[model samples]
Target: MRKIIFLGALIGLIAFSCARLDSFLFNPYKTDEYKLDAYDGKLQFRLGPEFDIPQDKIHLFSISSQGYKIWGIYIGDTTTISSDTVILYCHGNTGHIDYYWQRAKLLAHVGGKLRYGVLIFDYRGYGKSEGEPSEEAIYEDTKAMMQWLKDKGLTGDRLVIYGYSMGTAPATYWSSHDGPLTPRWLILEAPFASAELMVQDGAYFVLPKQYVTDLEINNAEWIKNAKAPLLLFHGTEDKLLALDPHGKTVFDNHPGPKQAVFVEGATHSDVPVILGIEAYISEIYNFIKSH
Candidate 1:
């Protein structure tokens, strides 16, 4: 009995340690409602009146992922989803859709007004979504969204997968893996290399990423397998993930047709604003057309 008790205690200790490390990785929070324009005071750039989306085009919906109801905002009419090229926006480790609303709005106006459909969502524990955020849960949540889009007649050729910061893990995972859908284009903005690199950067020493969390988020390795045309955006002055070990590392490891725009004086969240709205949109538009 004593031996069995000792083994159980050891297993409990390891699980506790893993849980502590997970807290450092995911930063999801609860919000009563997504107040797109009036919430969060952290937005550095806000769109003008001309950039406002028509009420008829905006959609707020939810779908099931691993028994959890994942919420999303689709910035176009459902009828257009079958024909228009859509962007499945996997947001960073921030709050929720409200936080990334401006970015999604910008994507809606990429080539012209409502030229491309944009879908941004709250991962399972963020905002009004159900359940907690785990490494696997986020991946499943993303897959669920893809299934929802597929049901709407969205084809793989019209799908563009865009990931920012922590969202890069799921974006790269789906791109690299043989799944139900493959992205027509993969766009990564300020991506971190891997969970291992993240843990090392935080501790200032090399350590096994599993010691902190069991997440298999390795963008550097996954990008090697992604064949879709890639467009990478990184800021030279990004202090959050840095240019060398994070963005550059992932960009270099990609073994396919890729284009990168290393913006000057832009930080992690300021890439779009610093790159200038017109130049940023033009780059994405031209890349999508050429590829």
Candidate 2:
């Protein structure tokens, strides 16, 4: 009887831990308007006036993702939506588009000032987007965005998929798999390799990823089949994802035309700022120009 009781208690403990792990992976805050100052306490520097985007150029809209309405922002001339090369940016798992608005603005200057259209959106269960969040939901949400782009006359050859941190999972997955559209280039910054690696990193043991979370995010493996030329950036001092286990692992596993830059002192959140905006833009511009 004691053995039976102990076994049941152990199972209960494992189940509870798994649920907690899953919840801890995603951190989102609700917002009706973009409060840039909300993240001020955590970030060392706020986006300056130089990064201000023109109100006329800023387009906000929503699309249906798995029957849930998700919001997206496009920074460019709508008149050129069909002809311009667009960068579909997948932001990190955190707050809504407001938290990443600055990053999207930076991408608008990638090739040149407003040379390319930049698109970013909030996934379901985040910000104003409705419904719950999950691994499959994110993938479908991202796919829905691609479909919207396709309907706008943007072809796979003119699309660039850029993913940072938690965003890398869907970016890598869609880039490799047969999806709504294929990207001409793949860019990853501060990418986590897989849920298994995440589990290994946090638990300090070789535990199965399923034991903690049902998330099957695996950029390291999915990247192997990606045909688009890859440009990857990893901060050497990234404490959140780390260099060796996460970013480097994904870079090493990729089997295609690839370029990697391990920024000297950049952290998980500030790769572009630490790498220098000019240099960051140059790297992406050159990559797109060459490929």
Candidate 3:
């Protein structure tokens, strides 16, 4: 009995140590100097004259959030309508919204052609936003920005949310719980199954598929409660996020009018273009129009 007890204690200690290491590696509260550097890189990318969209076509705005200022661009033929359908774009992890200048142009063209407005903002710790990046902080920032839009009189059906990569977390979280001001549509590109699964997959080649944690941002759960139409885009060849299963998982679980586009030969970063940008924009335009 003493030997069994000893073995039991040893197993408990091992489990505790593993848990500590996991917390250290995947601590949501942890911020690094590298994140600051990434923020600076975003600023350099955004402020240069090349990053500026044609001022004649797009209106630029800045809003204050806790310890940060979010800079965003609004694009449309503002003269057309006082209240237009607005797309709030939450971009991926790597770079700022400025990095998507071309994509913005395409989206703006679609918005102009389709008679909607487009707004894309950089998260705090990115571009002109003035703080560190954290899961909760980004969610608050998105909420603040959304409120700013609503304060300007945009309503649920007129507001669409688009998220790419890490952006999907905040978008999903906000869409799931942000009381009366729900978005009309939710678009997720290359979304992960959950944060915990992402970390597990990063640590081990394959996530075990059963472990549960509070830290997980289960888009699956959020989607079930989401009232908005959801459109997902994934690349069949995306190795980083594993398109087929993860994207399919979210699509299957989402309980709303939904569509998924799998780009044939594209990777995670290029699916937007490879799927035919025109068609992608048209899909969004059509979705907005139909709803």
lDDT of 1 by residue, 1-291 (tens): 999999999998987753556756689867867887676557768988888998888899999998998899999989868898999999999878888899999899889989999999989898899999988888889888988888898988999999999888888988998766888899999999998998898899999887777778899999999978899999999999998889999999998799999999999988999999989888898888899
User: How big is the positional error of residue 279 in model 1, measured in Å on the Cα after superposition?
Assistant: 1.0
Best by TM-score: 1
lDDT of 3 by residue, 150-181 (tens): 77778887788888877787777777886536
Candidate scoring better on TM-score of 2 and 3: 2
Best by lDDT: 1
Ranking by lDDT: 1, 2, 3
TM-score of each: 0.92, 0.91, 0.76
Where is model 1 poorest over a 10-residue stretch in terms of lDDT? 16-25
Model 3 residue runs over 4 Å out of place are: 1-54, 77-82, 111-114, 202-215
Locate the minimum summed-lDDT window of 10 residues in model 3.
28-37
Task: Please rank every candidate by TM-score, starting with the best.
Answer: 1, 2, 3
The CA-based lDDT of model 2 is what?
0.86
Of 1 and 2, the candidate ranking higher by TM-score: 1
lDDT of 3 at 36: 22
lDDT of 1 at 275: 98
